[model samples]
Target chain A: MRRAGVVALNTFREAVRDRVLYNLVFFALLMMAAAVAVGQISIGIEQTVIVSLGLSAISLIGLLISVFIGVALVSKEMDKRTLHALLANPVRRWEFLLGKFAGLVLTLAVNTAAMALGLLLVMIYVKHSLERSDAVVLVAVYFILLKLALIVALALLFSCFTTPLLAILFTVGFYIVGLYVQELRNLPVEVMSPAMTAFTKGLSYLLPNFENFNVMAMAAHGRAVPGALILQNTVYTVVYCTIVLTAAAAVFSRRNLK
Target chain B: MPGLAIEIENLTKEYPFGFLHLKKKTSLEGLNMQVETGEVFGFIGPNGAGKSTTIKLLMRLIFPTAGSARILGKPISDVEMHRDIGYLPEQPYFYDYLTAAELLDYFARFHDLTAADRKERVERMLKKVGLETARKIQLRKYSKGMLQRVGLAQAILHDPKIVILDEPMSGLDPVGRREVRDIILELKREGKTVMFSTHILSDAEMLCDRVGVIVGGKLRGVGAPGTLVDMKTQGMEILFELRGTSNAPLLSKATRTGDCYRLQVAEEELYAAIDQLRAAGARILSVAQVKATLEEFFTNLVEADGTHTSAVEVSGK
Candidate 1:
């Protein structure tokens, strides 16, 4: 447990210093800026347009950062032979894996909060006021964090056996496929063969339901976010993240450090 | 009981290719060796000679196909046993964003240490490796030698009983090498067992109390460096400038027929021959007995093709 904390802290420091983190932050900021400019050229629902676009942009950038950095974490350590040093110590493989995930998650949390605050401030300035229920923005931010947690877990699983580039590609591809899983299931059964329907249904259940966590869009339009729905999405993200992280730990334990 | 720091009996590790491949390559074959408590053992080999392979096996970084290794009489894979070992790899890596102190602090948590104890140990180690001045600077700017020193510091921070260093001196300058040598000697002085792998034979000669040399996935030799050098083919090159207008002593030893001296000593007499020359009125100029270095010994063993055991014999009886 102590070893995991140490590893996590070191990983967090290493991740925060990466130039890629800054680039993502910059791009996320630019996205909000673009959303604000587009809102000015808008038809009536300018506040709704700006908030929805800004939140979506932040979430997308956060997802990208989490997957890209998490996938590279283990592979980069192996590439530089640092994993050998860590393994040589009185540390367990599971501890190392958990520590890496924790560190990446902590970094994502900080970046997500910064991005959220940036969008919230712009929203407040535009309306000369912020909505009372705008406080629910925290829930949307939390949901986005949960989603990134799942992405980090998936990226870590890929990193266990593959190169950084391949891991990143597979993780992002999984995210895109996972986002469209609902649409994939809604396709006509008559138009698709039995095997295709089964495979697509299996994929839908296997992949994370990112659409279920789309509270940010509803919140931006001032729509009510049901408490039960947030609870359900949180439970789903937790279970999914747990499974992926466990699989990553299992595979990493068997890898040869040398 | 004060068990051996490391013990391996008939340890073999085989790596099999996939279904498409026909042969399996055994990386370590029937390796047997033991390092007693408080002994400095050197592991030496050429590149791709299975040095790292053996270390990885010892650390349980990879599962062995067969055989077993014990550390302090416990199985190599025993998690609790690792608390007694400290390892410094060839190129020790640290998070570049952290300072020397932070890096050690991060590693210190692995062992059972209080917050106060960790802090004290981290400071002490930084001082020990001569990095106290740079303790606050980010590791990104550290030179290779500095990086190595910090690596050494982290390895020993927990004060492990057995220190395993793989190619620890590979990138050190002469002064840095000497400093590391002093640290190794200090560890030995503290009664800690120190094992390090190095291709530099001279360092092995200076540092190891016992050494095991491996080549082609087999242990070629295991003993004190001095003992191995003595057993290998080393001779005395005596330069005798005859004290003369006459080439009498030179010619007499040469059988008076040839320009070369017919040295008739047996292999054991080589040392005595040089002593006798110094005793005789011959040479008096320079009498130097050249001993085979560990490098030459290792080269001979690797190139000797498993059957030849020709010992270099001196010819002056």
Candidate 2:
């Protein structure tokens, strides 16, 4: 566990020194500033516009960072031959994989928190006063983070067995499919063959249900998220990420690394 | 077995290529070798001769297709055994975003070093590898030689009993190579077992206590550098200066340049030739014996393998 922490800290240092978080955070803040400008032009619903645009910007930027960086997490080490020296140490292969996952999650968390804070500051600047319901925005930001963590795990799993470019495609593909998994689960059985219906149903359960974590609409409306839904999303993300990371470790441990 | 630092038995690695990895290419074939404690063992081979593959298998960076290996009486599969082992891969690449000190400190943490120990060790290792001046600079801006020095520093940061390096002298200038050579010698003096692979036979001849010459995915020879080559005297060359030309039959065959005649003769004929030259009043300058070298032995092994396989194919056909 200590060795894994070492690798994790080194990975975090690499991301920060590479200046990846800075560029993404700068752009996210810029988008929130734009949202504030757009909010001023609207006669009413200015808070709604800012809330919706700001949350969307945060989520979109977080997704971009998670998917792009997550896909390269393992592949970059292998490509650069850094894994050679690192794995040669006493550290276990699974530990290294776990460390990489945790490190990227940390980066995402920090990036998300920065963007979330920016969104709140933008809100305060425009509203000239704070609202009691404004606290729900933090909940919305937390949901986005949960969604990004799941995406990072998916990207890491793809990275373990495939090239970075292919990993990115697969992760994004799964995310796109995952967003509409409810529709797949509800496809009309009357028009479909029995096997097709069964296949779609199976895939709907197998793929992550990202829609469960979407709370931007609820937050924008200044409504409280149900405690039950929060519990479910948290549990779901944990279970899904554990399984995906375990699969990644298994694949990585047996890989030839040639 | 008690004194052995590494032991290998029938180690093999066959890489699968082609569509769906159906075709197999043998990178290493049933390699069996050992390195004793506190000796510098050189793994010498030409390109694609399985030297790096063998090292990688020993380091557990890659799994073997067949056979097993043990280090310090523990199986290669034992992660704990790695605590006593340090490895540097060929043309090692590190996280270039890290400075030299940070890189070493990060690696030192893997050994479970205390904070104070890590700081002290990182500084000492940087100085050991002659990177103290550039320890603060990120590796991305380092030269190839400087990066190689950092690779060396990280490998030995934990002060492992056995150090395995693949091509440790590569990508270095002459002075850098000499410094690395001195470090290896220093490690040996400290009673640390060192195993390194290189294609540069001269370096092996200079540093290795014993060398294993690998060729075509096979070990062609293994022994002390001098013992691996033919020790029998091939011939004797005598250099002499004659005041005037003589009709001595041996002297007539001698090649003359700058008032010196050089004559090469069989060991049996050396004395007779010397006697005849003396009779001709020739002044002997020097006498030396010619013997096969490690370089020649290495080249012959490579060429012999090529021809030997081709001959077998022709004969079978």
How well does each candidate reproduce the native contacts, as fnat? 0.76, 0.91
RMSD to truth, every model: 5.8, 3.4
True contacts kept of 2: 0.91
DockQ of every candidate structure: 0.65, 0.83
Instruction: List candidate 1 segments past 4 Å from native.
Output: A19-39, A193-196, B15-23, B233-239, B243-290, B305-317
Q: lDDT, candidate 1, residue B259?
A: 29
Leading candidate by TM-score:
2
User: DockQ (C-alpha) of model 2?
Assistant: 0.83
lDDT of 2 at A74: 91
Residues A47-93 of candidate 2: C-alpha lDDT, one tens digit per residue = 78888988888888889988999999999988889999988889999
TM, chain A, every candidate:
0.90, 0.96
Model 2 clash pairs are: none
DockQ of predicted candidate 1: 0.65
